[model samples]
Target: DKGELKGAGFSFQVSDAQKYGQAIGHIGKLTSGSLKVGDAVQADVDQARRQRIRLNHSATHLMHAALRQVLGTHVAQKGSLVNDKALRFDFSHFEAMKPEEIRAVEDLVNAQIRRNLPIETNIMDIDAARESGAMALFGEKYDDRVRVLSMGDFSTELCGGTHASRT
Candidate 1:
């Protein structure tokens, strides 16, 4: 591979990435030029976009704790989607959330956000994490060692996602 600038203003960006077996695949669109299998290239991440993603990811943890407080301990995370634009958290709940309940949850989350609690992450055995009351997603398998992310005493969960340094 030649150390050459292939093209400028080519509007090429990685739209999606996933892992299959032991390999990772980057899916993207190239506006110009053809690339051979071994062509060398540099990848730059948009730091601002990544910051937004971290903020949203951390917010989800706060929201989860708020939901449990307001909607009862039965609330369990079913799924989640986190990106720079937004975070969608799905959880188990029987009835539609009333407006007041929604507002209460928002207030609780906002209060924590205002505190700007420092985020802490620790790697420990899965059993120890469970004993520490770290919430894990149902039906999800985890290795013997796990990451336990905590935001003060308010929230703690088993997570492998990126998070902001503070609430």
Candidate 2:
């Protein structure tokens, strides 16, 4: 029951051009000196800033697992937004998660606080990732080469998000 469900397509159509265009537009806007607004950083984004943001995002995956473990068995990711200081995860569940559930989720996430698990990245042919048993997210695609991000053995996904070197 824990294995991946392969080749199941959603009923919706996604526009690849629109997705790439939106990504490019955002990058352009950030580089256009409009990102910082009134902040002290003043629209300056460097490698160090990116790495710092990645550290927080790595925590978000743990958050997803925590939610699933506490929230019954119906949770499925619906959407998300990730930025420098914070990370947001959205999932499919008929009812709202209860307050107690939220606390339980947080506590579970916090339990991994002191563990140090190294994160690893592999760039291999798409076939390699599938053959290696990586969990492919719904509605995701892979080219000839895909990037696999892993947190020890906790979670391994084909993603384009910032990440921590280790957990």
Please provide, for model 1 over 49-102, each residue's C-alpha lDDT reduced to its tens digit, 9 standing for 90 to 100. Answer: 778989999999999999999999999998888888999999999999999999
What TM-score quantifies how close candidate 2 is to the native fold? 0.64
Give the range of the ten consecutive residues with the poorest summed lDDT in model 1.
1-10
TM-score of each: 0.84, 0.64
| Model 2, CA-based lDDT | 0.63
lDDT of each: 0.86, 0.63
Q: How far is candidate 1 from the true structure (C-alpha RMSD, Å)?
A: 4.3
- Cα RMSD, each candidate: 4.3, 13.5
Clashing pairs in 2: none
Where in model 1 is the C-alpha error above 4 Å?
A: 1-12, 30-41
Q: Which candidate number would show the highest TM-score if scored against the true structure?
A: 1
- Badly placed stretches (over 4 Å) of model 2 are 1-45, 72-74, 131-133
